[model samples]
Target: MAFNNARIDAVPTLCASCEGRKKGICSALDCEQLVELAKASRKSTAESGATLLGETEGIDRYANILSGVVKLTKTLPDGRQQIVGLQFALDFLGRPYCSESPLNAEAATEVVLCSFTREAFERMMQESPALERRLYRQALDELDEARDWMVTLGRKTATEKIASLLLLFARHAEPPEKTGRHFARFELPLSRADMADFLGLTIETVSRQLTRLRNEKIITIENNRLVIVSDLRRLKARAGNS
Candidate 1:
C-alpha cells in the first residue's frame, strides 16, 4: 500500500502520546532532565512489510513509533505465524537488556520510529526511577493485552473473533461524532493476511467470515479501508464471553 511521506512527517507534531514528547517515558522527569533526553532521539521511517527485526535477531537499539503501525509476530518452524502484538504510534519496541528478540517486528503499514541506542537508554533508565517505573507499567499492560488475545484466539469462534477485534478498534477508535447505536466506521490497521495470522485462521476463512458478517448486516467494507458495523451489541453478542 502506498503512504504519503509528507503526511507521515507532519504527524509527530500532532501526536498526543507521551513517547512523541520530549520527556517520553520520562514524563515524570523535571524539565531539565527531559530536555537532555530528548536531544538523543533520532527519527527513522520504514515501509509497510519492512522487517525491523526478525526473531532471534540481536537488538542494539530500542524505539518508539512516531507514526503508523507495526506488528510483532512469532512463527513456528513449520511456517505458521501468530501475531503476538501490535506497536502503534507512541508505542515502544526492543526491550532494553534483551540480547535477542523472541518475535519478529515488521511494519504493518508505513511507519516512523524515534530510536535510541539500547545502552544509552538503559543508562538513562538506571538514573531515572520514574522512567523505570513507567517501563514496568508498560510491560504489565502488554502482558494483560497478550492474555486477552490468547483468550480470543483459543476460545472465540470466527464470528466472535471479528466482533472482539472490532470492539477493540472501537475502544481506541476516534470517530468524528458518536454515531447512533446502529453504525460506525474505522480503517483497519492490518491487512486480511495479518488479521488471519493474528486470529489463528486461514486467509480464506477470514474473507468468508467478513463476508458472512456483512451478509448478516453486522458490517460493511469499502475500498479495503473502512468498516462500518451496525448494531455493536449484536457484534458483542457474537463475541460472547470468549
Candidate 2:
C-alpha cells in the first residue's frame, strides 16, 4: 500500500473542521482514531475537468469527497468514453488496498477532498473493523446502484431515462424546499453532454427530452444548470418508477 509519490501531511485542526466528518468514511472512527487519521491525511481540491486519477494509473491515496461531484469514466480502445458512475459529497474515492485505478476519476464540479496516504489508510482500516464495515457497506450500495442504472440504460425509454437522471440528481441535491406552489429547486452538477454520456443517449435526444419536460410544466431549467422540479410525484411517474 505504500506510495512513492510525495505525501502531504494534514493539519489536525483541518480534520476537526471538515463538514463531511459526520457522514464520510471517517465517521466510523472514534475521537482518538480521528486524530490519528487526521495526522495521515491532507485536504485537496480539484477544479472542474481536472483528472484525479487516470485509467490504469497507480493510486497513491484514497479520499473522501467533502463537496462537489466526481465522474468515473472508462474509455474504449477507440477513444469512446462513457461515464460509469458519479460520486457526490461524503462518497469515498479510490479502490481501497488496490494499487491501480480501473477507470478515470475526474472532477465534474469544483471538488474538495480529504485524502490519506494509501499505506496509512490501509493500516487504519485493518485495525478498525468499523471502518472496514462502513466501506464494505458503501461498496454494496454502489454495486446495487450500478445494477439499477444498467437497467435504466438497457430497458428505459428516452423520456424515462431523462426523468431517471433528473431524479438521481434531485435525490443527491439539497433537500427540497417549497419555493412557489408545488415547486422545489436544485442545481445540476452534470452538463448536458455529461448527462447524455451517462444515459447512453445523444445530446440532441437529451435536450429534446428536457424541453418536453419543461413544456409539460414538470420541471424548469434556469441559468442552464439549475433545475426546479414542479412536482416530485409527476417527475417520478415519468421516470417509470411507481
Candidate 3:
C-alpha cells in the first residue's frame, strides 16, 4: 500500500488514551490536526529491555512515550557503555530531521509509545508551525537537561549522585501535590546495573550507597524495586542540593 494511503481511522481513539497528547508535541495540534496526525500513526508497546532504536540505524519513526521509562545509551568500540539519558512519559523519543539514531534507546521498564512514521511526522511538522515550534521548545529543554546532568556526572560524589538519581525518580514518579508535602513512594525503574551505568559508578558502589541511605533513615526499600522517601529534605541534603 502507498504510505499515504495507509491511513487508519483509529488515531483519534489512540490519542484519547495517550497521556502525552496534552503535554507532548501533540499539544500544539488542535482536534482536527490531532485526528489528521493520528491517522498516520499507530500505538506500540515495548517490553523491558526491548530496543526502540539502535545507534547508527536509520530513523524510521518518531515516538512519544506514553508510559514507563526508556534509557538512552552510547557505547564505545572498546565495549564500554554509558547511559546518556532517561526518557519518561510525555517525552519525545527521536530526532525529527535526523536520518540516523545517535544512541540506543531501550526500555528500562515496559513502555507504550505513540509511533509516527518519520515521513508523515516531518510532513506534519512542515504543515503545522505550532508543531514545529513545540518540537523546537522540546529540543531546547532537552539540551538544558543534558547540561545539568553533565555537571552532576562531573562534580558529584557517588553518594550524592545516587541521592540525586533517587530524587529525580521521585520527582518524575509523583510530582508534589498541592498539599505541600514532599514525600514520595515509587518503584525504581532502572535495575542496579542500569543505575550504575546512568550514574557512572560500579554496581557495588550503587548498592553500597543505597544501603547507606537506608541506614541513615533517609530512604526505605520495601523490596528490590520499591522505594519510599519519608523526608525529602534530608534526601536532598544528602544529594548535596543547596
TM-score for each model: 0.81, 0.90, 0.90
Q: Write the per-residue lDDT of candidate 2 for residues 33-94, one digit (tens) a residue.
A: 67677778889889999999999999998999988989999999999998999999899999
Quote the lDDT for 134 in model 1.
80
lDDT of 3 by residue, 1-242 (tens): 24465544344787885677778889898776677777778888999999999999999999999889999999899978789999998999998789999999999999999898898889889999999999899989889989978888999999999999998898788554643477888899999998998888999999999999999999999868899898789999999889
Q: Rate the local accuracy (lDDT) of all candidates.
A: 0.76, 0.87, 0.88
Model 2 stretches astray by more than 4 angstroms: 1-12, 176-183
Off by over 4 Å in 3: 1-11, 175-180
Stretch of 10 with least lDDT, candidate 2: 2-11
Clash counts per candidate, in order, are 0, 0, 0
The TM-score that candidate 3 achieves is 0.90
The root-mean-square deviation over C-alpha atoms between each candidate and the true structure, in angstroms, is: 7.8, 5.3, 3.8
Candidate 1, after superposition: displacement of residue 155 in Å?
A: 1.2
